[model samples]
Target chain A: MNSQLAAYATSNLWLIIIGMGIITFLIRLSMIVLLGNVKISDTVMRGLRYVPPAVLSAIIFPEMLQPAPHGVLDISLGNARLVAGLVAIATALISKNMFITIGIGIVTMWIWPFIIG
Target chain B: MEHSQSSPRREFWAGVKSEIPIAIGVFPFGLIFGSLGVLGGTPPLIVFAMSSIVFAGSAQFIGVAMINAVAPIFSIWTTTFFVNVRHVLYSATMGPKSQHLSLGWRVLLSYLLTDEAFVVTAWHYDNDNPEDLTHKHWFWLGAGLTLWVQWQISTAVGVVFGTQLPESWGLDFTLALTFIGMVFVTLKGKPMWGATLSAGAVAVAANGLPNKLGLMLAALTGIVVGMLLEGQGAQDE
Candidate 1:
């Protein structure tokens, strides 16, 4: 590890994470602590409803599409994470069960290397 | 629906029971986060501490990954803040239910709030009869504490025994799978589908960006698109 980077990480790591923790806690407390029984506006309410799908999909896409070691995109069958992710999506949609989807996805990833190799 | 005179203990246990599925799914995620944090070069003690304090799954993952990349500290904090912006919405959604509680209770619940806890608690609040909601806060406590305990145990296991575990296990991929499942579960209406697809497309297109800014960009774009579509539909109705 580069000494400069290591020192930077060691020095700033706690502050950043702790700041993040405080920020996260504040965000969670925002409406609960500040707002009192007022109804959320229609636009904001509807927008909030889409947060999970948007954020989760956003996170999942790059992780699945972008190769590790910061390599270029790999969308083909050779991308094991993408393949397992697809299977997991299918299982989730069909069964709407989290355990089954995750279980199958993990197993798929585990076996995909052998098959692709 | 008749309102039963339920005790706080009963409500608390109910919260725990309802949270079992979410807790189960979260276990592997915590383990992965702890292990990956170490593997990514963060000190094991910091990683273990993060499990309890930071507690948010995706943020910790991104934080450690950023640390590994040696990204600037400002970027790390900004990215983590973006990742957890959803909690603002959770807080809003939970606001009505929280109005009855005292400041201390509100603060505690807010600190405990996470994706899984929000979903479970929201479901309980939405479905239960209003009259029966007297002890519902206890239910929230139960669910939140259960997840907290589960997280600590799993993270400890991972930090202590993580290297001993084989790399072939492919445990890291489970985090992505978990998100995929969440996406599927949340995609109910056409607007939601539009948001998810657009977010995914944009995320892929912007994958090369530094500081994981692509994630925040995609999420914002998807929310705007979904909101517009929903507004259009409302006008036609």
Candidate 2:
């Protein structure tokens, strides 16, 4: 079992590393270059401010609540992440301090999994 | 010509000063990115260099993952191109405020632009006296420099021993957390809600799209939906 896991790790290491770097660069480069040249209206600009939070949260909440693969859809685990995330959110909104918000989030993530699992 | 002709470095520092406030939320993201890049097997030195040069967090993270996955250069380029398309909208919005500045300054700012800068700067504009982009500019410099330094330093630290870090840490989700933070800061009145809610709904529904372009498409869908709502209001009043 150990050897199998080790072998899987060794072979895929380099492939995973380079792929990550290239994709990351491409995403930001396009934004930097493109946003540099366009002409935006006030109404549109107001709208764009909201995009990151909405999309990211949409992606995150579902993933955090249930996770993936095994798909543990039970209310307890799901509720834990949901409640914890809200707590983190409130902390973030009130404090606007990264350490405090993330610290709370980490605690929630660690504890919730154990309590519910 | 006046400012650039005098001192390019001065302009650069000036830009950095004005751009600071928006950088606050972005800094931790860079720290997390650095932590993740090293943990994920990216070379330590290159991690810092990417932040200094590329200077874009989303791209750096995507690059870190794609390079390792060996998903082909073409896929990487396309995904990046589409993902960053929102900047086109962002650049357009900032144009009126930036037009008075030299082309060189415009180009420099464009390269430095990211989600945080766009959000903070976009909120504070007035059409009649547009050149007075004082606070907007400060917010960007504040935000950008803070994020830039954090990206390099944190990644370097991670590179030193990031590889040994465990998967359980899930540093990947820092991007998500950063997004949540920015969302809270940017969430305003109703028009904002329309774009966000519509975009999110589209993303969730279309999550099956290849290359995760569903999210990007959802944002595009959101822009249109937002425009329509505003248009409807114009007609109603």
Candidate 3:
């Protein structure tokens, strides 16, 4: 691990952070600043409508399916994260409340290890 | 027309109030990121700087992990861009409503934009009363600033004390739970379902892809699928 850190020198880390900051800011700023005046096409508008669900789903799925970062895919009932995710989904569907969904999900995750054992 | 006009100050406070619950959820993740970064061999100062500089939760997390893995700078930037490109869609959605605002306001608001802030601000805009239009941006500012402060403070706490916290507590799971909540709330109609299901499936299948290219590809696939389903629905109508 120290070897890995050694390769990532201090100057390089700073450069990466600044580069990430600029890139992220520009992505956030893209349409708001550049396309404020342009009339968006119907197709593009329709695509935009799906962005939230798609992007978020993309982020959520791997986290649930994988036991750890870069861990093997685990879709079985033994997978605690998968179980907690399903609980969260059911809670969201039923209650339509964010706090409740997250609360119940976290509770399920904490207790799940004991349940299976 | 008979109701009293709401002041920007009032709207701003309302925005801040509305964001409190979401901010509460996000706070733990900030702590997790801070602790994780420092524990993973990154300098504490750089970890704190990431919170201020990137101001994006997922991208920052991925960035720290990449730094620990000693990923190339170009790949880090590329992954960060892909992780955050969704914000472009948020900006576009808000563009029509905010077009009338001045350039400075646009720039500042854009900088403040994040997934949580976008959710609150968009909800406020969606249900906005005609009279409230003038001060809505203030509401956006308030919501953004609230999360901003919460994130910074949480990161500081994590950097200073996170290593002592037990990993068994599983504080990191909150991040996944938060995203799940966000996903379900935004899901509506058949097209939205199509988008979500496809994205989830593709993301899992492509999880092995390097530099999180899988996420970008999955998102695009879901968007296209959603649009196609919507178009087909329109034709049937």
TM-score of each: 0.82, 0.69, 0.88
Candidates 1 and 2, the one with greater lDDT: 1
- The positional error of residue B54 in candidate 1, measured at the CA in angstroms, is 1.7
Candidate 2 segments whose C-alpha is farther than 4 A from its true place = A1-76, A79-82, A90-103, B1-32, B35-42, B124-131, B134-138, B228-237
The per-model DockQ list reads 0.59, 0.24, 0.65
The interface root-mean-square deviations, each candidate in sequence, come to 2.8, 5.4, 2.2
lDDT of 1 by residue, A70-107 (tens): 55789898888889888888999999887888888888
Fraction of true A-B contacts recovered by candidate 1: 0.76
Chain B TM-score in each of the candidates: 0.78, 0.75, 0.85
Report, for every candidate in turn, its global Cα lDDT versus the true structure.
0.79, 0.56, 0.85
List model 2 lDDT by residue over B1-237, tens digit each: 242232335434544543453344344456666767666665566566666655656666776676555456566566665555555556655655665566565665665567655554454443213454434454445445555665566666666655565656555445445555555544655555677667766766676677667766777776677667767777888
Residue B45: error of model 2 in Å? 3.0
CAPRI grade, predicted model 2: acceptable
Best by TM-score: 3
Scored against the true structure, residue B39 in model 3 reaches a CA lDDT of 95
Q: Is candidate 2 or candidate 3 better by DockQ?
A: 3
